[model samples]
Structure formats: C-alpha cells, structure tokens
Target: MPSTPLFSTYRQGENRVTSSMLAVFERVGLSVTETILARASGESTLETVVFTNQHSTGKGTVPDARIAADFTYLFEVKTARNAIQDPEQLTGHLQLLDEESGKKTSKRFLFVLTPDPVRPQIVEDLADMRVVWFNFAALHDAITEVLGDALSAPSERDRFLLRELQALFEAEGLISHDDVVVVAAGIAHAEYLENSAYICQPDRFFRPGLTHLGFYAGGAIQPQIARIHTLESRVLFTYAEADLRKTQGRNKARIGEVIRWALDTEVREEGEEYMVFLLSGPEDADTVRLSAPLVNDKVASSGRPWAWTMSQGYTSLVALTRPGVSRTSDLKQA
Candidate 1:
C-alpha cells in the first residue's frame, strides 16, 4: 500500500488547522458584512450566514454545513504545503452529503490557503467531482468586491481583521502586501475611469518581469503606485506607414500599431514583451507605460520631464495610497 499523504496525517492528528480553517470562514463572513452596517435604512443586509466545521450526521461520515441545517457545503481546507492527493476524496464527501440529505443540494468546494495557483490537473479533477476551487487570492478578491468602496470607511477593527487575514494569506504564500495594495488601487482606478466617461476594459495582465501592470480604459497600463515618483510621465514615439525603410526599425512602428489596435480591440497574448502593446491605447491620445526604471532615469536626467504633466487622473491612486507612501508619492518627491 502507498504511504498516506502529509495532509491526511495532519488532519488525523491535529485539530488546530481545522480550527483555523473554520476561523477563516467566520472572518470572511464577518468582513463581507462589515460594510452593511453603514448601509442606509431600508437597505437589506446579507442573509444570516453560518459556518460549521465537522458537522455531525447519523451516518459514519459528516460533511461541513451552514447554520447546522442540512449539509449545504462540503469544505476541504488545505494549507500551503499540501497538494490534493486524492481528487476522489471530494466525490466521497458528495456521496455522503447525498446520503444524508436524500436530495442533491449541497455544494462541494476546496479552499486552498496557498499563495501558488493550484495545478490545472487538480482543478480539472475537482471540476470533475463538481467541486469549486477557491484559492486564497480568489477569496481575497471576493471579499474585496463585497466590501467595495466601503473599504474607505474608518473601521479600525474591520481593518485589523482584514490585515490579519491578509497576513495569514501572505504567510501561506497566497499574496503579497504590494499585490493587495495594487489590486485595491486598480479597483478604485477602474471605478474612477468609469465615472470619468471612460470605458474601462475588463481585461488585465500581470506577471513577473512585465514592464507594465495591466490594461484599463482604452488599454492603458495604469500603475497604482509609482516606484519612482507620483507625478505622471510620458514617452512618445511616432509611427508612420510610409517610414518602412529600415527593416529593423520597422519593429518600433509595428509595435506602435499594435498598441493602437489593442486600445480599440482586445489583445490576450501572454509573456512580458508583448504585454506592452497588449495593454496600450491608441496613438492619438496614447497612454503612458509607468516603468519605474525609466521614470527614475527621466527624473535623474531632468527635473521632472515636461511630458510628465500629460499624465493625470490619479484620484483613485491617491485615495488608495493615502495613510501610507507608495511609489507614486516616491516618484513625486524624487
């Protein structure tokens, strides 16, 4: 027989991990509803939520439940280091839920508190079992979306709980603080763009070594915070269809054309180099690609380039970065 997996061993011997998982669910429910406290009268709040771990049934196996009502969810919480050894495990839980409820209504979900993305095969296997996978980052995104602009409200207790949750997520390698801030700023920026008469695109791209953050309205690479300064900066390059003399030089114009086209359309290529054009706007009113190194160099060479003034509308950026200095502020000071 094969050796048991580490997760199985941990589950059999330890209750603390299970307790923590339950706490995560509880905190998520609380944080999601914290904003409702500020809602106007007559505005409805979320339904009374409940999270129960290791719910008991008359049968040998028990499934997690909501509010101790009939089993409505089967939750398998995994720590950062553990991989799903048996995808069929969820199927067993599903069977147990069916046996207990006599009708199929319960949902199965796997909560991975890891920073890394789950393996595609594992995801597929879970899907086969009718199980939804909610990674830590996805959970954070859901919570943030639920809170909306109410995040700006001065609720220190709520903020502390959120920070603590984020700390746990970070320790498990779910996300970095910088990533959280950037995402928050991006959400705020997207809202700002929508309110400012710009059609913000839903597509965004971010990965290591990418020179730009992600695309926004008109395929603009909107950086949340600048590593160099808060002031806006611009780099201009003109492309003419007639200027195709040098074959090597034609690449720049080709790139420029792609950027222009991406603004009007969607570009979904992966990797670093192509991401620049993949997230740029049209040539007429081009969007700036906020590169820290380039911005720093511009600042060092000259006292705030004249083109910097062309970049504006950082209201969301300012709101997100307040109470703490960010790259945007750093660049402004520089």
Candidate 2:
C-alpha cells in the first residue's frame, strides 16, 4: 500500500518543521493558537480579539465572521543554534515586521525559534522588546498540554495532525522524550533522602535523553525517580563552596554541611567543581519515595547472590513504573 507524506520531502529542514507546526495550528482551530500565543508572548491581547460564527439571531450559521489576529507574529525558525546567530536575518525580519506594524496600537512580535536550550547571545542582547526567543521544547509542552485537556474536546483529526508534528520533532532531534538514568547513590544517598539533590563530578555525563534521575543503593534501585529541576532566572554554575555560599544565600550553610558529610573530609577545598542536580517530585515536592523498592534479582546458578556491578543504567519511564518490574535488570538497559 502507498500513502502520502504529511510534509514535503524536498523542502529545507527548517521550512518543513515550520510548515508542520503551522499546519497543526491551522487544523486544530483557534483555541490552540490563542493558547500558544498567550503562553509564548505572555500577552493578554488574544483575549480581546473577538471571534464569531453564528447568525444575527444567534442561530447556527456558516462563517458569519472569520477568526483573525489584531497583531502580527512573525516566526523565524532555525534548525540549529548557530544558524540563528546570523544578525542579518533577524534584522531583516524585524524591519519587515516594523514596516507592517505602522500606526497600530496592537503589539507585534518577532518570535525566534531554535533547537537550543537557550537563545544565542545575539538574541539575548537584543534591545527590542518586540523580539521573543523560545525553544522547540516549550512548543512541544504547550501543544501536549492543550491537546491533553479533556474539556478542550480535541477532535480525532486534531490529535492525528498534532501527533505527526510531534513525530517530526522527535525525528529531527528537536525534542527528547522522558527517560531515567539510575546511578549509584553511594555517600550521596543520605543527601537524596533529605535535600533531594545529587552532586557529581563536573566532567561526568549521563546518557542522552534522560529527564529523571534514580539512585541505586543497598543492592537495590531506590523507589522514586525524580524529575530534574530547572530555574528560569538562574544561569548554569559549578558547585564550588565559595560560589554556593556567595550566591545560593539561605541554603548556603546547609548545603556546605551536606557536602562535608558526603565527601567525608575535614578540610574542604575551595576549588572543587561539581555539577548539582536538583530534584523535584510530585507537585514540586522536596522528597519522593515509591511504595516499594526495585531489587536486583540476577543471581548465580548456585542460588547465591551474584556480584552486582551496576555503576549506571538507563530505562524508559514505562518500564520503570510497570507493576511486574521487580528486578533491577528488568528496568536497566544495556
């Protein structure tokens, strides 16, 4: 059997991604569009835009009025972080938006979308308030949340098109699905139980696409897997004692105490560098514990416990949370 592709094969990567996104927005109708725009721009102007599709007598009618936007939203899509660094492209787009936005009280936005977690330094330094920078992850989240709403009553066609867009995003490496990385808790097990954070060497890297962190202790994997925490206003920094004390305020002294206990050292070096992973549980809680622990049942033929040598492992959320998954080996990936 033969089938037609949802998006064009010969188009450029950015163009294809952009087209898929626009097609989904158009097909899903006005609510999704207004919700996304409200979230991206943090503006309430979408509420003021009146939409009607009925007769003068308030009876059901065909297209009494068409949905429209009072403002303009120009999207500049880039496949890679480096591609969006070209100042000329942004300047040209902003100039055109400005020309089209003349003598209007309504707002105009030039939304720059990229695959990077953060916008490029050029976009960050832009003085124009009309410019907004966002990543594909945010778009994915917004779309998923909107479609998952039961009250919104999304149609089957809407679901199919949006799912296709998500598939495209995953294929292009624009987003990563949730996965778990289980590592040895060691001395930091206590820290996890209390403060809900894990610290490791700065050079150590986890497997790609991991969104949650799990701990292995006492010949078993811990009950809970925590979602990695993020701060919108904070920049990345190393976990140095001096820096943490100076910048972390309130939690500084407590963090130092915990670090001392974890390291089991008397004199702490000021130059030590570690990457801190803050953890958040359900409802943004400080701690999380599962009903039961996941144990390692891989044993020798003689019925004695085998030598466990799991430093770290990766598993999907579906496998980890399944009811019959009792052994650590069942969830751990090679």
Candidate 3:
C-alpha cells in the first residue's frame, strides 16, 4: 500500500499503513505462543525461527533453519477474525506446517488467536489434527516476559487485574485509549465489516425505519416493562462503508459519541462522513445556525444541501436544513 496525500485514513507523512498495529499483532502472537508453550510443555525460551513478507514463516521447516527440537516445538499460529467460525483458514496454515516442518516432531500444536472467541469450526478442525486451539485465553493470559502486568485479563467486576497483564506484554506503552480505539477499529474494518453485524446496533430503544416504513418503531415500550442499561454494549456495530456517517451536536457528549464512532484515523477503516455542530470555536456563539452550501439544487431527491466531489464527480448532500431546524447526519440506527 502506497501513501495517498489526499487520503486522511493514512497520514500524509507516515507510511500508508500503520505498522505499529501490525507490531501489536506480532507481539500478541509471540506472547500467546510463549504462554502456551510454557504452560503445556514447560518450555519458556522461544525465538523467531522464521520470517517473511507475506507469509509469517515459509513452509521450509528447518533444513538449516529449524530450531533445536528439544527446545523449540513447532507452533503453527493462525490469527483470524474469530476462530469459531473460520476454522478452515486456521487448519490450512497448520497443514502447511505439518507437511513442511521436517523435524517430524510429535506433540505438534496448532494455536488460533481470534478477535473474539473461537467458533465451532475451529474446535472441530483442531480435534482432527490432534492440535488444540487456545483463543482469547492466550491473549488474555500473562506471559511473564512481555507485559509483566495482567491488563489483558478480564476484571471480576469493576476491578482490572493489572498485575497479571504486566507479566504478559512486558513492553511499556502497551495500553491506552488510543490502543483500544486502534484495536476496536481494526476489528470493525477487517474481514468482518462486510458482515451485517457491524453496521447497526439497535436496542429496544433504537428503531431505524426502512425506506418504505417512514421511520417509526411501532410504539415505545414503558421502562416498567423492560429496563435495559448500557444498551450500547449490546450493539454489534456492522455498517456499510458507504452508509457509515457521523453527526455531532454542540454538546460535548453528542460530539464525543460522533467522533468516537466516526473518526476515520484508525487501524480498521475510515468512516464515511463526520459533521460537527460547532457552537463556539473562535466564532459566534449566540445565533450559530446550519449553513447550507451556496450552490444548491432543488431537483435533487434528498432536498438537502449538496456538494460535488471533484474527484469522484459525485454530488454528495452535505447537509439538510428546514426553516429553523438543523438536520443531524447522525446514525439513525442508534
């Protein structure tokens, strides 16, 4: 991937893609392998015996390259979106290692690291190869070398088990707000965004209207009938790149939500649109109102303010406003 100066997804000066994220993936792989090998075989010392550009390590096994068998047990690592559903991909990599790794070692293992839990497909695939799949557990586990803290491990309620996370990453600056955003955004943009689940997160409260339905959720339910807290947590966001957009209000909370969801500067993919309602930004604060683009077309179906993209030649409706209303470009799917 080359750099595009016009594209905001990739920074102008930096590489087209962020290698730090790739490094994090590699780090996770190394940590998981170390932890698993340590726990299963009582082997702790590990090294990168193979390296490559496309493939992690080629199928060459150890001719002059294979590590000492007594010390190094060949680990076939497969990092996927989720191990459960995408088992064949995991098995495919293991099959390559099994035939290629010439030490002809027994007790060979296949490890699958997934963004989410391993699916049934992964479990079934591992059973056939006599290889076991250790999923989120390995990533969540403390390797005692890399992290030295247990930040990856889940907390029992409100408490985070940092002591254990320290043992795993061992690297400084491993976790932060930017880290979470990068990770989450990466997952959303990768192999799964095309899937429907990433586009919408509609709870009982949110009810998006189909084009024909005109926008109504039958009727609102009473709180007494059902009270669901943290509805945002339940949403599995899956949006089409084209349909994805963001709207921010003058209120910080509203803008924060929009920025969090719509910020295109991320690892996964860039968002479609981000509209902010600025109340005060070295400008007027009293009668701040929606300003439509001067060049408007009444013939357009949206009947909204439209701006033409010179690059694409697509006239995008920038915003829509009525007499005294500011129509937000917010996600109707909530």
Candidate 4:
C-alpha cells in the first residue's frame, strides 16, 4: 500500500507533530529518572537552550544515547556532510542499540537520517530488514514550503543551524542538502507519510502520543515552564557522543553558562513546595556520579554542603535537572 506523505522540516530545529498542544513541552522541566538537564538549561524544555547551544538530556530509559526516551520505535540517527551512501548503516545502529538496550524491546527500529539525496540502497536495505523507509527528497517540497519562502532571514538560532547543516554536507563533500536523506527502519507507518502508521521520526520527532504507546507523557511532565523552542522535535544537534561534544563545544560554554545561571537563580529559589529535582547517569554509578557532585553543589551553594560518588556504564540518563545552587525559601509562590 502506498503511504500518504506527512511531516515537514522547516529548519534545523523546528517541527510540530501534534495539533492539540495543552502547553509547549519544550518549556517544561523534563526529567528521565531524576536528573535535571532541562531546568539546568535556563528554563525547562526551552528550545532556545537546545537549539542555541548543545544541551544534553537524559531519558528515564534508553541505552547508548544519553538523551533518548523509551519509545515504541528504535532507530539510529545518521548525519553527515554528504548524504547517506549506504543503508547498511542501519544494521550497525541496530547492533549498537542491541548492546545498549541489552534487550530488544521493540519490534521496529529506524534511522531518520539527513543531508538530502538518499542513496537507493538505503531503501533496499529496508526491504531486507522489513523496516519501512522515508527519504529526504520526499520531505524536500514540504520543508521548502515552510523554510524557503520566508522573506526574513533565518533567525540567529537557525543561521547557526544552516551553517551546521552546510558543514555536515561539506564534510562528505556533498554539494547540497538536495541530496540528503532520512530513512526509517522498523516503522511500517510512514514517518512523514501516515501518522497512524509511524509514531516517531529521526529527529527525536514526537507529537503528543496519547494514541502512541510506550512513550513518556511529556505534556504532563512540567506545567510551569514555557517553551522557547520545540522539543527534540526538529533540533539541528541530534547526533551522539563526539557529535554532541563537537556541537556543545561550538556553543557549549555559552549554553552551559546560561543553564548554570538559571539553576542558581530561578529553580534553586523555587523553594519547598515539594518541587522535584531530577538527575540521572548511565549506570547506577554514572547517575550517582553526576548526581553526587551536582546535588552536593546545590547543598554547598545553599550553605549546606555534603559529599558524594558514582559508578559507570550509561545506556540512558534522566534526572529532575535541578539547578546546582540552592537557598532558603526567600521567595514566594507565583
């Protein structure tokens, strides 16, 4: 059966998957297990924080990748300066995910890759894996309709993104994104095609998934925060490890500075209303590792210092993402 086309990427980090937005999930302070990356990131779930800088998030459950959520679809996100030359990459991603997850939880996994002109083998491999596939060109017209016709120049956030995309393209000597691609494995539904069939996209793409199973209730996560940008919706920075570090370094300190400042200033001050402080690491050890220092810093800054430690192995991470510094209830409710 031919699938209907769906999804449109306007820019690097700007795509909306749902219609009924109770509030922007981007603004809310999202936590996986207990760590607080989002809150530390200025305002919780601020698109500005993620888009402007390379901010890492930890999901309540996921392996290998730190900032991923436990969802129905599992896929690798392959990004390059040149468009994908092979679909076999997805197979490797599957193996990595297998190691990270330790258990094959989903029946499907996918790869929502980028850099235009998709290689045909990418789709051919999908046939081999029984994984449905989608490519960059399919989305080109829709994406262009949203991003290309704009009279104004791209935003500072987007300009940086365009440059990054260009860099990725050039890294492989690709001349243009017109040749980029996004492939999906494990998805019988189309990522940009039929919403009913596909649940998630490569870019950590998500809409409110009430009908979708196994994904977190992101909308219910935080109510106080306001979205400055979208969630992992259409972020430009979506790769893992070195990719994350590279992107962070590009705007790391700047973004970190803001997050640090916010935790010290705002959340730390939100005082004793049973407000949660989330944190997490890869292993019970990693969680302990990041949490110990982070939690201690909050106490010490609050004039009540303490000590701590951590372990190893990081499949995924999540914490309430609280601010490091803390203080007495000097402020009142809003």
Candidate 5:
C-alpha cells in the first residue's frame, strides 16, 4: 500500500507552510515572538521589520529573523516535491538584509524549510551564507527532541497538538517520534538478549509499533519468565514453547499453521532467522496474555524435547497481556 503523505492538501500553500515552520521554531525551544505574516506576494513583514534602518527597496525579500531585541532569522519556505527553483533568490534576500543592517551585531540565520530533501549542490551554493537546510525529517527530529517531555506527558491538549504535528511530519514521509521510541526500545531489548532477537524495522521510514518483535532460539524451549531489558526500559513476560498439534485440534489451526509454516520455511532458508508470537484470544478482547518459549541450554539438554525450529530470517510474533495477569495460561477465554 502506498504510504500516506505527511502533509495534507490544505497545508500545501506557502503561507501555511511558513506558519508551520514558525510553529516548529517556537515549539523547539527557540525564543520566537513578535511575529508578522506576509500580507501579499511581495510584501512581507520580515523585510519591513529587519530593514528599518535602510531606504526602501522594491524587491520582495524575507528576513530569516528580526525579533526585536531577540534575534533575526530569514526564512524561505518551499513545499515543493522537487529541488528549489531559484537558488539566487535566497542569496538576493541575504544581500538585501546585509544592505539594510550593515554589519549589525544581531545574530542572523537563513533558513530553508522544505518538505523534500535538497541536493548537495544546493548546500554547496549556500555554504558561505548562514543557511540551514531543513527537510521534513530533520525538522521533525528537532521538534521531537525539544518537546520530548511534553509528548510523553499525560496532558491531553499537549498530546493532541503533538499528534497533529507528528501527523504532519509523517505526511511528509518522516517517521513520527512515537515510532522511533518503540523501535529504539525494541532494539535495546534485542541487544540485551545477546543478539538473540533481531530488530525488524531498522529503517526510519517504516512505522513499527512496540509489538513487532522477533527472536531466535536453538532448540526445545521451556516455559519461563523472561525480561527484555533495554538501556532505558524493561518489559517482562512469561515465555512458553507452543504445542502446535494441540493448537491445531482446538479450532486455532490457522494461527498454529502459520507458525508452523514460518518455522519450517525459516529453517530451510540459509542464514535466515525468524520468530513467531502466538496471540490467542477473542477478537474484541481488550488484552490477551502471550506465551512464548525461552530457549536455553537447560531446555535443550532435556531428553523429552519439544521440537521447535532454530535459525532465523524474518518473522513477527505478537501477544497481548492484560494488566495484573501474570500467567500465560491464565488468559481469559473470549
């Protein structure tokens, strides 16, 4: 399926794009105030505010900033899917600012905000100027870092706005911060297991929630409580080796069959590793307890072994856990 664009149709205009840029700057720890919007195609408040000391020039230019007693930023916003049309326009704006300010002590930044990534040549052309190129992904990262605390808080309003911004960022083909957290957590968990599990979604472009996890085991596994510990987080769960034959006879053949099929296919593929988590419950249940096996030497050494495949390629396992429910077998029936 084609992925959804990060920006909506209504927000594709230059003005709306510019407003979004300002919102990001303000939200991302920048002391932005005393703002002005462009009234027409050529008339912008940026030029007026920053060029107060110089004579009027009919050329339309946007100043990166000129917040009184604060800072000056000149921003040019482009929502195009292609490269910038005219690089000289940005340079011209900078020249205009230089003429007006004439070596003033104010800090100036030329910002180019675009939905699409720019070419290397574009960066080279603006190398001498105070230009900073920000595509949607880069900008999203900045906003996420700045608002990390607010995004994690329980405030409904803050979360709502954060989601809106995240949606916008995702629409522009950028991964949301929420997905990043989940993936990062999953990676840390995988690493802590001594590389027993492999992360599925390593690419930042794909969205992998917390449930997308896979593991590797060498032999028959036994039921045990395993804690997936990462640098910053930990998740504890009871793992048990699944009995496919028993599951097949219980009208849960589809899931069992899939797991069996994946195990069989994964073993045949050279150097391929895959794992499966069986989630069994009512379709509408709020939570379901998951059970998977912890493969260890003790379980492998046991003579009466439960045959589970080893090696890995690609597989996904997901099981739901109910609050206050500890045992996997204690999962409530649908």
Candidate 6:
C-alpha cells in the first residue's frame, strides 16, 4: 500500500488530496501541470497562462529565457457532491479570485473538482470566466494520458512520482468509476441507440458514480456500452403536468425534445412521469463494444444454461473485460 504522512491529516477531508496533487505537479515538472491546467481552463490558454510571452526579433523569432507570469490555479476539491450547492462557498471563492484582479496575475482560475459524473447546475450557472468545473474521473484520465506520453522520455523519477499520485487518487476512490448498470432494453434498444437517450421512472434508484450503461437485448448483453455518455445530466419531467418538478439539470428545450421522443417511443404514457438520461450523441466513439458479448453460458444442475431473469443487473468494467466472464452471474458488483 502506498502511503504518505504529509497527506494523512484530516484538516479538511479533501485537503489531503489537494495537497498531494500540488506536490505531484511540483515534482513531476511542467508538462503534467500545464496539461491539467489546459484541460481545466482551455487548450488555447496554454500560451497565456503556462508559458512565457514570446517576442519577435528583427530577423526571425526569439523565445524568452525566463518564463515568469503570475498565473494562479486554485482548486476546490469535493469528495461528495452536496457541498457544491452551498452558495456561500462558491461566492467566497469568486470573491477571492476577484481580489487578484488588481495584482499582476495574468490568469487566474478556480477549478472545482467533484466526484459527480455531471457538472452540477449551480456550478454551471456561475457567470464567471475564472471558474472551471471538472470531475475526478476526467482529471485521472488527463494525468494518465500525459504521463503515457512522457514514458518515452528519460524522466524515470517523474514517472514514478506521478504514478504514485495516480495510485493515491485510486486509494481514495476518487476515480474508481467502474460500476455499470446493465438494464434490459427490450423494445427501446434501437431507439436509445439512435437517439442517445435513456428514460425510466424518476424513482428508479441508481447507485452514485455509476460509470456506464449496458443494454441487454437479444437474450444477451449488448457488445457496446454508453461510456462516453455516462450520465451527463439527468432531468425529471412529468408528462401532461404543467409544472416541472426538477428542471435545473439540462436545457429546457432539450428536455422537451426528450419528452416528445419518449411519447413517440411509448416509453411514457399521458400523465406519466419519467426521468430522461441525456446520453452523448451517436458518434462512432460514443459507445465501446466489448471484446465479446457477455452471454448466459453457465450450466445449472439441470445441465442447461442458466436463464437470466432480472430486468436489471449490476457489474463493473473490470468484470466485463475479464477472461472467462461469460455469464451475467459472473458480473458481481464491485
């Protein structure tokens, strides 16, 4: 087990992770730091925030030797999702960033890191350019990708520390979004595959941090999963009801389209309520086909393949990719 005494404190639950992140960025060098910053801010912000201002000479071009620009990145890490609703917390952070306007700060950003799969409405509605919202799973992916590129270089120490940082995040369960919901998509499988949307009763409880959606059809689980559209934002709509119950998750017009689509598909009847999951668009990369379709092949005492009877089941990405995992029974919840 990897452990560090500097990050073993409880001053703030997320402070340990935040401190560890800064420490790793400081030790691992500029590439990893700039990659994460570029992700949180924007790719075009690389020259403005992370690098020195280049000057043009009379002959050709010249790069500044000393790269010094006061760019500040403040992180607010949340292990849970509820704290994002605190208006005072976000307002205070904005005030802190505003105070730097008079200083020599070329660029400043307040990066909010949460475990939520989707950006909360409160954070999304903030009318500030300094605020950048990102989730932990994305952060892990960005770091892992940058480090992968760095592996070809001679920076062994950098790779070792960064790998430790990745391990620390995993140990804290910040990026462990392997859990998936395998639901029976009987009649609406094609509709969902085409529209990139899924609807169910508002009361249907899915575990927090469920990463993927696996459709079960044709007596076997679908080879692909809606991984890219992993619960982007969910909105609750009551058909034939004038008043909307929860309308802050996604765009109102888009919600209306989904409601109309549900009606066309007969998934929601008149005066019925449904929660529509806004999946990613039907692009080639939106869903991932597994190595092989998971089918019910296990034999029972009666010398026949056991039948799958559940409308829904839980599994993990690890289990889906594991060898010899052919039956739904092998997909134990992680």
Clashes of each: 10, 0, 30, 43, 22, 0
Q: Which ten residues in a row have the lowest lDDT in candidate 6?
A: 240-249
Pick the TM-score winner: 6
Query: Which lDDT value does model 1 have at 146?
Result: 42
For residues 1-334, could you state the per-residue lDDT of candidate 4 as single tens digits? 2132222232432121110010111222122101121121122221221122344345554343333344223433333423456656766665655665554443334435343232334555466452434332222222233235355334455444334433433444332222101112232211111211111223432223111111111111111111111122222221232134344653343323323333444422221111111111122221122222111221456677432212101111111122331211211100
What lDDT score belongs to each candidate, Candidate 1 first? 0.37, 0.66, 0.30, 0.28, 0.39, 0.66
Per-residue CA lDDT of model 3 for 194-296, tens digit only, reads 2211222323222221000001111210001011111132322224422332332223343344344543434223433332221222122211223431222
User: Mind giving the per-residue lDDT tens digits that candidate 2 earns over 240-284?
Assistant: 553465556545544554455445543223456566666764335
TM-score, one value per model: 0.35, 0.50, 0.27, 0.22, 0.35, 0.58
Q: Compared with the true structure, what per-residue lDDT tens digits does model 1 show for residues 79-182? A: 53235667576668767666656644443323323333333245564554444454555555544544456645525555565556555555544443222112
Give candidate 1 regions above 4 Å deviation. Answer: 1-18, 27-71, 105-113, 149-159, 177-334
The C-alpha local distance difference test score for the whole of candidate 1 amounts to 0.37
Clashing pairs in 2: none
Q: Which order, best to worst by TM-score?
A: 6, 2, 1, 5, 3, 4
**Model 6 / residue 291 / CA error / Å:** 16
Better of 1 and 4 by TM-score: 1
Worst 10 residues of 1 by lDDT: 226-235
Model 6 gets an lDDT of 0.66
**What does candidate 3 score on TM?**
0.27
Worst 10 residues of 4 by lDDT: 309-318
